[model samples]
Target: MDKFPIHIAFNFVFLRKKITGIRVHAIELFRALEEQKETKYIFHVITTKEGADILNEHGIRANGGIKVHIIASSFEKETDRLKLQLFSLNNTLKQNRIALLHCFDYLTPLQRPAYAKIIATIHDLIWLENPNTYSLPKRLFKKVFFSHSIRKADALIAVSKTSKESLIQHYGHGYDQKTTVIPNGLRNTFLTIKKQGNPERLIKGEYIIAVGRYLPHKNYERLIKAYAHCNTKAQLVIAGSDMDKSVDLQRLAQELGLNDKLLLLKNPTDAELISLISHASLFVMPSLTEGFGLPLLEAMSLSTPVLCSDIPVLKEVCENAALYFNPLSIEDMAAKITYALNSSPILQKLIENGHERVQAFSWENSAKQVMNLYDDLLLNY
Candidate 1:
């Protein structure tokens, strides 16, 4: 069988099938490719049931205007799941015409001998940081899988300059030749939705909004405490799917006597989220670590002024377009919130700046870069 020039299959080895940052990138890339009628490319995605469902909901499939393949497998352990994914991708490639394999993570042993030119996108530098953040078994697993993935990938695409630097620091190779920096693209739907719901609700009160999964890394616990010290009239609304470990955060909110002021909403629709972000007096991100913070851009695209942590990656993404608050200092966070609440002029300027800055990034532009990269690699081969 003659392989197509851009028959690329992306593999993200996992059984959880969460629509995380990696999955979002995969979907957006395909969406961008599908829009270009002149490009003859087929982007197949091998994932689990949940991932397939997500793509299906977005109308992306092999039969639905874009070429996508969903390889389903069930395995409990991470290593075994990866091994299963490797075997599946290998079988799929053998039966079909595939020239490129763009894997989100590293390939397993079964995929190593395949003839496809591989391009791997590293979503984070998880291995560079201390392993003590997770349990003993997880630490051991990271030591194996993360290290192996980086070593084996033909071309490494980092989602941000920070991630690229972290990869060079940890892997000791692929700094110049194989590694490339491509920032994560923002979805346009966040800005397209016209904010029209209850006008009465809009006039209810001014509040700050924070959105993310209820994970420890998001540092919502600290955010709630920090918000407690803000103006009594200004409320903080934390919205996300309550994770397995988020019960502690809820308890912390109660302990801080913020049961009424702090609102916890679970898994809101994108429209609802956008409304919240658009109407928010301030959008804050107090994450301890992030590969690329998508919410910061989403808020900015909605013309919402952002108050994010003073972390390097956040600063890199937000630039001088956002107001920064020290993540370590509750005093600083509270003060920023207070300042925003007290000054209408500052709020207007920040929102304008945020809107202007976020215009530079788009899913279409990201997709174009990825497609062009594919063409270049194919020519080289």
Candidate 2:
């Protein structure tokens, strides 16, 4: 009963140091799938030098059915002009003669080997939702890339049910059947059965925490503006990477005379994040749009009281475990945060509900679903 190795390429080319929901999804799912690492399935992970370190930590190496290929750069820029290589995947596809190419990011190669079946994980159709958040080039690239990949891909994995529906609604025709809703899962550390958090880098006193990179779609600016109006005395701590680069979040806080009350920690390590989340009085998710609100689930897992946007994705992830607010209305967000912090009964209920809600999501569960999808896709091929 000898079985041939099925070659599959994991497109981690675009992963950078900045921690986003996509990076978390890819790494966590892979970690869960790592338990089944053997010769039955060959994993060709194409990634950058930094990404390799993350993968290597999970007992992943080139010795087994896994082969790690480190590239110099994901994609070389030529004076802001887009290239056809599409994260340098086409050549890799052709050279490796890959049977199935799984794209963790939103993009797939514009040109790839004919035999290669593409399975792209679409996080969200945020570009279609918020045209102003992206520049003309990015918007155009996303529209073209999304359309081509959705139409061409053998199957698409949407991060949430809402994301799946968004694909069908906007992309239209031949999308609903192919797209599968596979929600992101939390790390074991966050589970109440395990440990809520590791005390790595401790920030003093109680604080209201929010985690996300400094991106326009993340809606940090509005959150900061809302924080100014809140009556709560809790420190506003934003543990996002590269906040100093993307937007002047600190200066915004300063303009509102919140210099002492606001703490902006850039690129906090995972242990630090766990400590922050576990100890926080409240965790706020003020995203204008998201495919799946991973942070909301993470907060719930850590037993932190959740105050987030009333967006469908956030609701879908946290369910009734969170207090909701209008993402657009700064006043609503401020009021919600203040109320959540002040209300002991509600916050306690959220923490209790959080423990129960998080039981449904796990890396193991997500990995199982992914393996099932992989088996089905490979069976046809």
Candidate 3:
């Protein structure tokens, strides 16, 4: 007798919004699954029209093995839109007889078919950690919807052990058996990109690089202050999308009289970002918290030394391959930056160790693990 292929569905609704780390993960994982020949599975992606367009732009829709289900819905109101999506998703799963659904953005159809199992990936609980950062309505939505989705999920994937612990700590116990720590993987493009020499227009001289969204938890203000106190003449290059916190960081730089030494590139293209990381003297992650610190891994893959905040998740992600600093203490952060830049031997070791550490993660491996989990879940049926 021949073995049957497993049919699974993936939620790609996140593509409707601006591209973020979560969206990237969904895309990369899908691509990896498509490339895997060892697994005989039929993959179905449930996405909005916009999501389909984005996938088409990336040539992902060209794969004959993957089926794309486009659900049309208006986005005028969040609640109504979710309702429409849930209805469409439930119908899609039942119509196609999909045995499993993987939600990459910590959300799922409110009403799932009895035959379909859910696996949700919780990237972070930032709003739960700091409610003040979000609006009251947003917080309420997250509290209600996220809690419902998580409870309904048959299994969960946490990007890091720290993220898994946070989930249980804030949401109560009994999640250990259901949750798996699967770190996000870097794109092969970042690993293969040739390091470009500094473009005088992009940066004046040797620069320290930082990349992330302009969010309060990112701690850009503290990083700017610490960079000012450093003895080196290297410019501080911060590349990320500008959000509500952008003005505050810009004002802080101006107030410190270091505007000339600070470079802010908002929403850089992937090629530009890779080039920047490839040539940087060091890549720093000043965020007070991170789900997995994907950028640190990206830097490591590109042979760039990393300096990140002394947070549990950062430590878990970088191991001893990265230099750490107190995110809250400007003095400590400055000292660590200076030490990293000045100590050639330590920097060399970090670069080598980072390369070795990054070998442990790859999209292909992560996809295999996910496929195995699907197999385990479907075996019961």
Top candidate when judged by lDDT against the true structure? 3
Give residue 67's lDDT in candidate 3 (0 to 100).
87
Runs of candidate 2 with Cα error greater than 4 angstroms are 1-3, 37-39, 71-87, 188-201, 246-248
| Model 2 weakest lDDT span, ten residues long | 76-85
1 versus 2: better lDDT goes to: 2
Q: What is the lDDT of residue 171 in candidate 2?
A: 68
State each model's CA lDDT, in order. Answer: 0.72, 0.79, 0.83
Residue clash pairs of candidate 1: none
Compared with the true structure, what per-residue lDDT tens digits does model 1 show for residues 59-145?
665663345455654556666675566566777765656677777654443464356777877777653463434678766766777
lDDT of 3 by residue, 239-261 (tens): 98764447777788899998888
**Winning model by TM-score:** 3
Candidate RMSDs in Å, in order, are 3.0, 2.9, 2.7
Native-referenced Cα lDDT, model 1? 0.72
Error of 2 at 381 (Å): 3.4
- True lDDT of residue 132, candidate 3: 64
Task: Please identify model 1 stretches exceeding 4 Å from their true place.
Answer: 1-6, 12-18, 37-39, 64-66, 73-83, 105-113, 130-133, 194-204
1 versus 3: better TM-score goes to: 3
Write model 2 residue lDDT over 1-381, tens digit each, in one string: 123677888877666666777888888787687775545788898876666776677455676667888764443452211342264667877777688888886677778887778889989888889777778988887888778778888889998899988888886857888987787888654554335335553877778999987778888889989999987678989887876784477778779998899888889767778888878889999998988877777788777899888988888888889999999999999888888877899999999988888888888887788888888887856
